[model samples]
Target: MNLSWQTRAQSIAQMKAETFDILIIGGGITGAGLALDAAARGLKTALIEKRDFAAGTSSRSTKLIHGGLRYLEHYDFALVREGLRERTELLTLAPHLDDPLEFVIPIYADKRRNYDHPLLVRAGLFLYDLLAGKYNIGRHRRISQAEALQLAPQLDPRGLKGALVYYDGRTNDSRLVIEIIKTANERGAAIANYVRLVSFRKDVNGKVCGAQVTDELTRESFNVNARAVINATGVWMNEVRSLSADLSDDDKQLRPSKGIHLTVSAERLNVTTAWLIPAIGEKRFYFVVPWEGRVNIGTTDTDYHGDKDAPGAVQSEVTNILQAVNAYFPSAHLEPSDVISAWAGLRPLISSGNTKQATTAVSRKEEIFTDRDGLISLAGGKLTTYRLMAERGIDLAVEQLRDHFGVQAKPVSTKQIILSGGGIKRVDLEAHAHKIARAENVSIETARHLLHNYGTNAEHILALTHEDEALKQPLLADLPNIAAEVIYAVRAESALTIADVLTRRTRIAMLGAAMNCVEKVADLMARELGWSEEKKAQQIAAFRAEYEREYLIAR
Candidate 1:
């Protein structure tokens, strides 16, 4: 049942032999959520991803689970309201991955811009809290200029004014996607990564009945027959649609927005609470989030017309973020050299012909598009409301199934079902982690890291250390990550490539010394997966190339 390379052969064979009720394309959060919902409802489901799970926008997000407070400016109350509800659900369903964090919006007296006015900001927070209702993490409060400085010493005190403090949730974006996929697989849904949907199979009536899939790793082609096909690919929606049939100029959809973020050491900024700072002259505001012991500052939203697969962070984009961070925290004086890593993601916004509209003005509301060929594509939604998106997408899919195939399926109840590793209570997490630490004879930090990242599944990793003491050693002296994580990713998670282990599974590639540990981790993966020496070398080189391409900013 383990989702490893060893099981991929068997899984692909099964996929080709058996007919499924639903074939899900794209393994991001939207597709993962739908697969879990469908499988939980007792439908035969299968999911395929061309790259690693969450390899797209899902992994490169600002990493907040908050209702978009800025959406209030655009009067996007419904999107914000739905996002708030899903935020609360995720905190309860996956406490280990999502946690509450405090945010402050500093108001300046000298710069009384309409958006930065204290009264206006407070009013927005009021509506934000009202929408959250009982699900509100904490009530918003106002503080004096002095108190604001006390809370965030690094803040620029030149334009002294008060600030508003509110609460929201943050998460490890990639890890959340992986957990959803794993939960679906555990529930009997056949999920395969590195499997690309090459084309579609249609009947004489031109209805999509199945898909032609290819294993990217093995270069093997096969066909999977299904009663329904769901296209959940994010920015690549139009690209996948082309495989079914060409579209006219008017039919071309998706206004992809490029958003880039930079990661710096927490010590450089030294802010305990997250900050929402309005850009000097733009309607958009940049986020200064503290995550994983580092400061994550980001996200410039501009219309993108580049290759979807290679959304690299340009120097101009990085400079914009740096200027914003420096303006907010004058004392920090953060330069490009302070940046540890940088990433870019494309938001799949449903295009409105108004090319004059700013990217920020685009609505994040999701839409389900069904063509005459029965190809259902879900596009243009934020990560916060993925569950609701899935529910709506599946409702349409089920309706199609009943109408076209004459099949009956149960209703979805994914809200009641906790995702994998969600059963552990927050109060008992420390004690449980302590017990595991003692049992495994590893450091407390290491145990807590495992518990937080893998949740209740930490025990499975602890077992690896028991089998081989070498697995308990740290991958890097400064990092808490152990060698066992690399092995567990291969044996338990479907990590086919070194990039899968380093970038998505463990996040070692984003941290410092990523290149230094690549060969070592590759060696462990080779030992477990039986990679030849040449393959191991290839993995190391490929991982380094990806890190330099996607993460490294030119010095």
Candidate 2:
């Protein structure tokens, strides 16, 4: 089924009429993975999301698919190993979205990381590669200070010792989740965004059998009967669990830690590889990643007590990030003016210790809970390990189906759930881009951009350009995204609102051109999606407001 607005009506009918073998709540990467796993295993599956897929942490990730290399400092070898293994799995399953990259960590003789000598870094890197074992992308090596400067001219030269270079991976986190969702739908999973779970519908014996839900767009409430209901909501797990029964307030399973990131012009930050820079205080750290045409400097880990739905980086947080960037890259001279975009994401870390203390040390390990009432809830995990988390969550749900529902479903078979954009090897991608450029009459850069995000499906986008020659033009003068992408998002990617296109479907949001071309983007969307003039204005306003509220530095 094409995952478009047209298909949503049919999906809703299915959601209302069919009894599913497994119904999953939450459309983040974890939930999407679960739906794909269950459906691929020959179980009747359906998924519901209160908002858009990846509206929460799934879209707000640091945009990396690497193993948890930092976890090694605390001796969490198993966690690192599982993540490393998943990294290899993702690179194979979706080669285009998740590509391997070299990460440079420069050592300073007078910096706070005094313990990180060249030999010590080598030992850690060796252990990291050992954990990855056969799945390792590349081996780590030591680089002289001069060689390090050649890669990143921004690196501070004074008191700088040699650097350590290691291999990791990067990805468009939200795009990855959306592709997984589309694959699940193609495999017969009826998944709909903006359909929210209202409450639990229980049997006379008080075990979960179904749920009451409302479509947010239409506000029509209905019942969805399912043999097993799994709550995979990230930060909102507690809220969904509360709907089923009276759980204690003290039974909070998620401690949300807010991590914020900033994007600046790549020309200003200037780095060939991602940089791991240690923070000066709070025992913190951040990553300087090369993303799109910008540099992403991020991630302050502080316990977030604010509203989870509207997490934004405040001025002080922005100042701290720029300070870190400038301190590491003394010649970069970055300031608030240099920042193109800034946003915050709440990490749903599982609290295994004192909840009253800081959330910085909480584990990234995920846990699945089966309530005595038969409601299952999942919390805590990283984006890189989402597939593994789904496998484990669905395994337990399959057991529950046999025990209570009498539905004998097939075993998990998602190890082969080829993402919709799969099968494009790295070596083949360049030739594919050249072919697309020649056939579509677009720039090599634009063709490469489409292939990177849509992989083999780039042809589908190219087909749109033939119908409207104007669709080949760039969405913004400087951005690589073209107008055909907006139509593609509406027709193939199920993007509903302006936020869905600019924020998740395309790179406009964090790539820093959201405000500059909102009206142009909205006009194209209105023509394709059949929006009224008022709706177009509303969408433009909402997209601009979202950028101001979330992506802009609140100075």
Task: Report residue 280 deviation for candidate 2 (angstroms).
Answer: 2.8
TM-scores for all candidates: the values are 0.97, 0.97
Lowest lDDT 10-mer window, candidate 2? 111-120
How high is the lDDT of residue 282 in model 2?
Answer: 41
The residue pairs that clash in candidate 2, if any, are: none
Instruction: Tell me how far the alpha carbon of residue 114 in candidate 2 is from the true structure, in angstroms, after superposition.
Output: 4.6
User: Which ranges of candidate 2 are over 4 A from the true structure?
Assistant: 111-118, 249-252
Models, CA RMSD each: 1.5, 1.4
Off by over 4 Å in 1: 112-115, 249-252
* Candidate 1 C-alpha lDDT tens digits along 237-317: 988988897777645468999999898988898888898888887667888998777788888888999889878888887
Write down the lDDT that model 1 would get: 0.87
